[model samples]
Target: MSPRTEQQYEEIREEKKKLIMDTALQLFANEGYHNTSIDQIARTAGISKGLIYNYFTSKEQLLQSLIFSGFDEFAQFFDPNRDGVIEKEELHYLLREMFKLLKEKMSVWKLYFGIMLQPQVMKMVEKEVYQYALPYLKLLVDYFKKEGKENPYLEARFLSAVGDGIGMHYITDPDNFPLEECVEKLIALYQ
Candidate 1:
């Protein structure tokens, strides 16, 4: 193939890779990852298992990639801009932004909630997410520390825990949670 033709082929390949990953996530959510097989994923996705391998070497790789890609998407979406550091005032914005994001990502969030309790899945998620989260958490904490908050690290982690709790409550019983209001109330303390 010519260089331009080869480039187009690569683009098409990448799109197929993403399509497989997306279908795999839905199947994994609906059928459970351990129960879902590569052949099933391929059959559901209307592609051959050989084609799936062109994208992901194994089911575990695909699952890990799904989790990692979600984190990557979150990293991008969490930022209001391409700017590296989050301003202190943006902390408030982050709460509503995250809640909105979680609400929008209900399917994936549900998968996340269900899978986290599984030891192997939990380990994989923790390894992938914590590596990504810690630095972002540190950035948030440093922003608070600069603003003269004591124990910024602990406070930052606490906010994450609280947010997770509220998010889970919202997912399970949104009518009862009033999550945005509760989150806003908590954020008031930081101001």
Candidate 2:
């Protein structure tokens, strides 16, 4: 076999990193982050404990990576055109896509809500969470302002709270949550 190239090595590294993150997400969501150990994740991923350290400086860093990755995935749906303004159709698209993502990545969202409910875990990541959230909140406020809402910031916050409630309920009872209907109502509300 020909010697592996640099690109091949990078691909292997990325695959291993994803494997570790995926395993960690499962354990953190189902088993609780504090209860899950690095050794446990390494064993689950079929890698050495040391390998995880190579990818992440610490377990907290790994958790942060998982959380940040989910935020990054969400960024794509928020402002696809990179334009400052959010049109009505764009708002609708964002809601539809957000629900689709929640359905598709239940485990990730479960971890998110799980972390938020745990005061300690939430404290650990609060700054980073706010860092990711502020821009999106600003965009929503701007959109609501353009829509002539008297309390655009409040409207933005209300929509965020609603989204969080929907996500929490859907994750808790996905089989009968009426997610599509909720999404339709949310879209209409914003319009």
Best by TM-score: 2
Whole-model alpha-carbon lDDT for candidate 2: 0.90
lDDT of 2 by residue, 93-161 (tens): 888988899999998999999988889888889998998888888888999899998999999999999
Q: Give candidate 1's error at residue 143 in angstroms.
A: 2.8
lDDT of 1 by residue, 110-135 (tens): 66766776788887678767677777
* Clashing residue pairs, backbone N/CA/C < 3 A, model 2: none
Task: Tell me how far the alpha carbon of residue 41 in candidate 1 is from the true structure, in angstroms, after superposition.
Answer: 2.1
Candidate 1 contains a number of clashing pairs equal to 0
User: Model 1 scores what on Cα lDDT?
Assistant: 0.79
Give lDDT per model, in order. Answer: 0.79, 0.90
Candidate 1: where are CA atoms >4 Å away?
Answer: 1-4, 79-88, 173-177
